[model samples]
Structures are given as structure tokens and as C-alpha cells.
Target: MVAVLVIMTAGALLGYFLRKQPKIVMINDKLIMLAVFGLLFLMGVAIGSNPTIIQKLPVLGAQALLIAVVGIAGSVVAGSVVYYFFFHKKY
Candidate 1:
């Protein structure tokens, strides 16, 4: 967990410093997409090799779906509130 946090912090700082470079920003998007797909592919491979997780996939999927729905709903509510308070009047 600490390693993950350190890596994330480092990436955030790098992105912040690189924000002024449009070429780097454009390349970052493509690189991020490639990295995400690579990570997903590796995750699929790991899950495919795990017999226990495969057997419990149905339960896990349902829980993941529930969490996703709740997260989306919360985000929408928060976004609407922010828009109303901050952006609605500007428009």
C-alpha cells in the first residue's frame, strides 16, 4: 500500500510539472490508455489462472456491480450539486 501511494504521488507530481507541455499531455493520454489496457489484460490473465476466484466470480461480479452503481449515483449527485452552486449561474 505504501509503495502504491508513493508511486501515485510521484506520478501526480510528474503530471503536474508536465502539464504545461501540450505534446507531453497528448502523449500522456495515449500512454495512459495503453497502460490501462495492459493492466486489464494482466488482471484477466491472473483471474483466469485463479480457480477459486473463478468459482466465486458470480458473487464478486454482483458485489462489484452494486459498488459501481452506488459510486456512479453518488458522483452524479455531487456533480449536480457542484454545477448548481458553481457553474449554473455562469452559463
Candidate 2:
């Protein structure tokens, strides 16, 4: 919840600034790449240090991939529904 608030505040600030300079957008691929790489590094460290985790990897890996795919799909659908209800009408 706190993280959501912080992101909302940051997004608001970025939007406000962007209005003043329509040519400039705050979010870009580089930021996304940085975040993705950072998360991957952390996940790698966690997986590397846990012997039990590694041992169970063969069984868990497929399950994890399926869960991740489902979660991503659900999130995308939810986001689209929320945006359609909240913002699409305005545009």
C-alpha cells in the first residue's frame, strides 16, 4: 500500500512536469530494463544461496513458470478493465 502511494505520487509529479514539456516522457525502456535486471539479480542471488531451493528446482520450475504466466495475464486483464472503467471514457 505504501509502495502504491509512493508510485502514485511519483507518477503525479511526472505527469505534472510532463505537461510543461510535452516532448519529454518520464518513463522509458531504460528504466524498465534497469528494474528488470535488478529484480533478476536479486532472484539469482536468492536462488543461488538456497540449496533446498536448488534441489527442488526441477519440480518447482515448471510450476513457477505457469504461475508467473497466469499472474501476468491476470494483472494485464485487471489493469485493462480498471483503465477502461476509469480512464477510457475521458479519452
Candidate 3:
């Protein structure tokens, strides 16, 4: 956990210092996308390798779907409230 925090802090500092560099920002974006894809692939591999997990996937998937739907609904409601209060007023 400490290692993760340290790495995250280091990345944040590096991003702050390099904020003005468009090339570096582009590379960073690509690297982030690649990392996300790699992580997802690894996750799929891990799931595929576990028979018990596979057997439980239907229940897990329904729970995940419920969570995702609730999350999206909450975000939309919260975003609408913020927008109405902060940005939608007539100037």
C-alpha cells in the first residue's frame, strides 16, 4: 500500500512538472490506455483460469450490473444537481 501511494505521488509530481509539455502528455495518455488494457487482459486471464469463479460468474455478473447501474444513475443525478446550481443559471 505504501509503495502504491509513493508511486502515485511520484507520478502526480511528474505530471505537475510536465504539464506544459504536449508531447509528454500524449505519451502519458497512451501509456495509461495501454496499462488499462493490459490490466483488463490480465483480469480476464485470471478469471478464465478459475473454474470456481467461472461457476459463480452469473451471480457476480448480476451484482456487477446492479452496481454499475446504480453508480451511473447516481452520477447522473449528482451531475445534474451540480450543473443546475453552478452552471445553468442565466447570466
Ten contiguous residues with the weakest lDDT in model 3: 82-91
Give me the displacement of residue 87 in model 2, in angstroms.
28
| TM-score per candidate, chains pooled | 0.57, 0.48, 0.69
| Tens digits of lDDT, candidate 2, 40-88 | 9999999999999999998899998999999999999999999999889
Give one digit per residue, the lDDT tens place, for model 1 in 46-76: 9999999999999999999999999999999
Task: Report backbone clashes per prediction.
Answer: 0, 0, 0
What lDDT score belongs to each candidate, Candidate 1 first? 0.97, 0.86, 0.97
Worst-scoring 10-residue span by lDDT in model 1: 82-91
Q: Note the residue pairs that clash in candidate 3.
A: none
* Top candidate, metric TM-score: 3
Error of 1 at 82 (Å): 12
Q: What are the runs in model 3 whose C-alpha is more than 4 Å off?
A: 68-91
Poorest stretch of ten by lDDT in candidate 2: 20-29
